[model samples]
Target: MTDAVDPPAERLLHDLGITEPGEIDVEVIACAVGAVVRYRRLGVGDARIVGLGDRAIITVDNRASRVRQRFSVAHELGHWHHHRGRRLICHGAADQQVGVAGCEREADGYAADLLMPRFMLEPLVAGVPMSFDLVYQTAAAFGVSAMAAALRLADVHPAAFALVVEEADGRRWFRRSASLNPRWFVRSAASGVSVTADRYGLSRANATFAAPAQRWFLGQGAKDAQAFQTIDVMVCGRAIHLIVVA
Candidate 1:
């Protein structure tokens, strides 16, 4: 099993005196870490970090959503904390490209931890039934996007759950909770369209239902297993699916 990487991020939040589900002021954290944050109308990427000795400058695209901007700021801060003296450019949700670099994924994980500290999120999700409403509520509580909250929940939820973020062009990314068996593999159509995609196309927003596990997983166990609850939401033309095993 792989080790979790949220401890350092949690420690940073601890040092910042943030111990609850509330707004995480990324700008303040950047300044505290000796970085200057500037908002610009960036054309190529959502954000980037440029280092100069002990200090750095973080440039964020002003065109992105407020929540996206917050995550971008936190992502740059992660780079500063973990990969000092290295410059990075981050593409936002609007640019849904497949495949993320190791450093980029690590920075995203750190940002998720920093924005939604495990200490606070664990208790909030404990014993709570899984649903799109729950994810949205958690997102509101943490002042993050629903997709971000869903991804965090997949990492922390005690149950066997998986969160899949699929783009319109068929490329996708998924995260599974530790409880899920390592051999399980999620299934996706060649065209990237599924029942969830159909619902998303109709509503272009909220949709939740239950489907056979084989609809998403092709393994023998998944084919014979019972149904799983699927909650989906559309974000920036991407379909985010939250599947909870029964």
Candidate 2:
């Protein structure tokens, strides 16, 4: 039998009377969901959820940044609400890909929506130029990491925007805005080199420049070989490249 489905994050936030675009107190939301929040020195990951009788205990990594702690707490609460009775350990951006694991993806989606509600984010990003400055502003307003803010913008913005994140070891993941055509696949260089990698080599933390679409996408026809503007931002030692295609 199929598992019972929980409500989406939007409905959950609405039911909790959260309609504004600002910092969401995930601790308060956890209490409302009957989960206890605690802090401990977790190993490398963000947090874990353990089912205790009818309630759950969420233990967050004390050493993580404040924004990561917030997202971790919200992700554990997602487990409480969606996958009850299953103990879950969550890694932050390290495991947040499109389709690596089902539960992790669901919980990440829940955390993203709960933290940055689309209804609120849509209006906030409307007419704003797609740039790292806008992403930093949004992250400050929403109390989420700059990476999270960039991902949210790529998810909801009406324009064709794409965000690619690369780790120190050359591993990468990417997400594109709704208006972007699905056929476009981001290309990885022979040695995992990318625009963000080049910027990192120069010790640049933030930059905006123009490059041919082929620099990012693979198999681009002449018709699609236009110039694309890229905004690169370094967050917590990871490279976040935001590409705006015209």
Measured by TM-score, the strongest candidate is: 1
Pairs that collide in candidate 1 are none
User: What C-alpha lDDT do the candidate models reach, one value each?
Assistant: 0.73, 0.72
* Candidate 2 segments exceeding 4 Å error: 1-7, 87-99, 190-205, 219-225
Choose the strongest candidate by lDDT. Answer: 1
lDDT of each residue in 1-246, candidate 1, tens digit only: 124554777877778887776647888878878998899999877888889888989899998888888888888877888889665445543221226666777788778888888888888888997777888888888878877787788778788777777777767777677677668787544123454465656454455566777666666588676555554645656677777778
lDDT of 1 at 8: 78
lDDT of 2: 0.72
- Candidate 2 similarity to native, TM-score: 0.84
Q: What shift in Å separates residue 183 of candidate 2 from its native position after superposition? A: 2.2
Q: How do the residues 179-241 of candidate 2 rate in per-residue lDDT, one tens digit apiece?
A: 776777765431234455655664565556666666677654624665455546456666767
Worst 10 residues of 2 by lDDT: 187-196
- The runs of at least 3 residues in candidate 1 whose Cα sits more than 4 Å from the true structure, single-residue gaps closed, are 1-6, 87-98, 190-208
